[model samples]
Target: MTTQVVILAAGMGSRLGRSLPKPLTELSDGRTIMQQQFDNIHHAFGKRAKVTVVVGYKLEHIVEAFPDASFVYNEQYDQTNTSKSLLRALQASQPGGVLWMNGDVVFDPRVLDRAAEMIARDQSFVTVNTAKVSDEEVKYTTSAEGYIQKLSKTVKGGLGEAVGINYISAADKAMLVRHLQRVDAQDYFERGIELAIEQNRILVEPVDISDLYAVEVDFAEDLDRANLFV
Candidate 1:
């Protein structure tokens, strides 16, 4: 089966203050953030990867930049959050596992190489950076069994920060979709993952990638930090 991948690029990204979609923002290396993500995906999965980007704000810009990618438009992008965008992508996907990342994240391709083992085992996971846990970023804590328990911005005693790279196995995809629907429109996709763990007992492991560079570019400072890695 082909490896399904989704890039959530519909948000207006007002924080970044860029006219183009955040993913299209040019990096120091001249490759856009989305371009680096595509290169990483291809390097990790080769021709087996089927990428679907969820587009909205300035959708045409992204559409023109990556002509080969499949897309799903989120009409309510301005009114909704990642939960809705991710929900749409999941709905459009075939009955299989999916690997997704926030469009603005610029990371070392080796991050995906680290995740390849978990993907092969069909396990659900969230890539994390244990080196830092900022109050603004999504954080998480694991259950006694070492599976992710609490996952959100307000998680107390957070073990690490979720780096916006995640996977949902085929077995857990439907449940995640149902939880995504239940979350509020303003809620991040992490809320749905929390609900799934709380209600359905889905096991989501935290794959630590602190040794690797994975930065989600939201502010100018973040872009600066990400550029250092690239």
Candidate 2:
């Protein structure tokens, strides 16, 4: 089975207050966040896995950073959100399941290792963390059977917060593409997944990663926190 890894890195890091794209932000280890992500995915999937990066803010810079990666330009990246960028990437992906990761996170390589294991088991799941769920976090509620029942930042007391990493089958990817096309461009990509769950077109399992380090960089403080783990 062919597996594609899609990295969504188009948006400008306005909140981070950095002139560079979040993916290009220099980490404590000197490697950019996207470079770390590429390394981790390569470590888990080897050379066969195709990596497609969606770029918008600084296209030339991102392109130069990953010359080997296939690129999809999100022309309206400033007006849209991750959902639209991901949709563009998914549409350009190969005919198989895809491992999706937001470009702004710095995480333990084990997150990719475990995500691949879940995909190998023929399960589609979103990585979640038992770490403190703040109001700003993208939260989700899972059924007792481990399927995600709901997903939203406003969902108080969720099972865990979404780690912005997930595996989606080709079938589900088709469904998501269609759903996302009909929704608001500002919606997060997970909104489509929530709709799929509601329509019974897919079941998203939540895999816990509380024991591992996964940080979503949204602000200067978050970047500092992520640097601690890096």
Candidate 3:
């Protein structure tokens, strides 16, 4: 099956206090977050998955940074959330399984390598960190068999953070797109996935990535913390 990767890179980094968009934000390592993410995705999928980056804020910067990447713009980026950005990407994606990640995280590239293998076996799942988690992150709980039962920022005493990485099988694309479209502008992309699971449209297992270092860079402090990991 063809594998496609969609990157949600359209957000303005308001919390990071940078004029750069979140995807264009430079790390101490001199690589922008989008560059790091693209490298990882490339390493994992090689020529297997075609990648499409969704861009909005400072669209020209991202376009220049990744001239080769297919892009779907989210014109209402300032007014919408990740769900809307993802919806546009889904509409543009070819028929295939898709792997997606947020634009603002830095992590070990091997995580996606491992995720690629896991998704080949399971078809659908969310990459999660099973170590100690915080209330500030999107959290989830899994059944003993590793299928995610619930996911939310308020999922108290949950298993781990969602890590903003997820996969969907091509077989579920139509249903997934329907769920994404039903979500309101204020809701997260995860909300649609949750609705999918609730309605028995899909089953998203949890794949733990505790062995690898990954962090969503939401603020200056988060960037500092991620520096230590990289």
Candidate 4:
């Protein structure tokens, strides 16, 4: 099966305070953030990777920037959050597992290489960095069986921080879609994952990539840190 990927870039990214979409922000390497993501995908999966970008805010800019990529528009992007954007992408995807990442993340291409095994097995997973856990970042706790138990920004006793790179197996995608549809409009996509885990027993493993850099550029400092890796 071809490797399917989705990039959630519909938000206005108000925290970054940029006129352009966050994914369009230029990195020190002179590649836009999304361009680097595309490069990483191609490096890992070659021509077999089918990328679908979820666009809304300044959709035209993103569409023009990557003419080859497929796009799904989130008409309610301004009124919703990642949950809705993700739902739109999931609903539009083909019959297969999907690997997705935040549009604003700047990371080592090796991160995707690290996830290759899980992708090949079609296992649902979330990339995590065990080196640091910030209060503002999405954090997670593992179950007794070593799968992800709870995931959210407010998760207490979190074992690590989620790096915003994730996968939903084709087997688990419909359950996640149902939960994503039921989540609040302002809820992050993590909420949907949590619901699926709690109610449906969907197992999502945590893929540790602490040694690799995966920074979501939300502020000026974040951009600075991401530039260091680029």
Give lDDT tens digits, candidate 4, residues 95-167. 9899999999998989999888999999999999999989988999999999999999999989999999999
User: Whose lDDT is higher: candidate 1's or candidate 3's?
Assistant: 1
For 109-147, candidate 3 gives per-residue lDDT tens digits of 988988888668747889999887898889998766668
**Candidate 3 worst ten-residue window by lDDT:** 41-50
Off by over 4 Å in 1: none
Q: What would the TM-score be for candidate 1 when compared with the true structure? A: 0.99
Candidate achieving the largest lDDT: 1
| Residue-level lDDT tens digits of model 1 in 68-155 | 9999999999999999999999999998899999999999999999888899999999999999889988999998899999999998
Give the RMSD in angstroms, all C-alphas superposed, for model 4: 0.7
Model 2 TM: 0.96
Q: Supply every candidate's count of residue pairs whose N, Cα or C atoms clash at under 3 angstroms.
A: 0, 0, 0, 0
| TM per candidate | 0.99, 0.96, 0.95, 0.99
Off by over 4 Å in 4: none
Residue pairs in clash, model 2: none
Worst 10 residues of 2 by lDDT: 196-205
lDDT of each: 0.96, 0.88, 0.85, 0.95
Task: Give the per-residue lDDT of model 2 (tens digit) for 54-173.
Answer: 999988999998999999999999999988998999888878788889999899998988888887876778999977788888999877777898887878778779999988876677
Residue 87, model 2: lDDT of 90
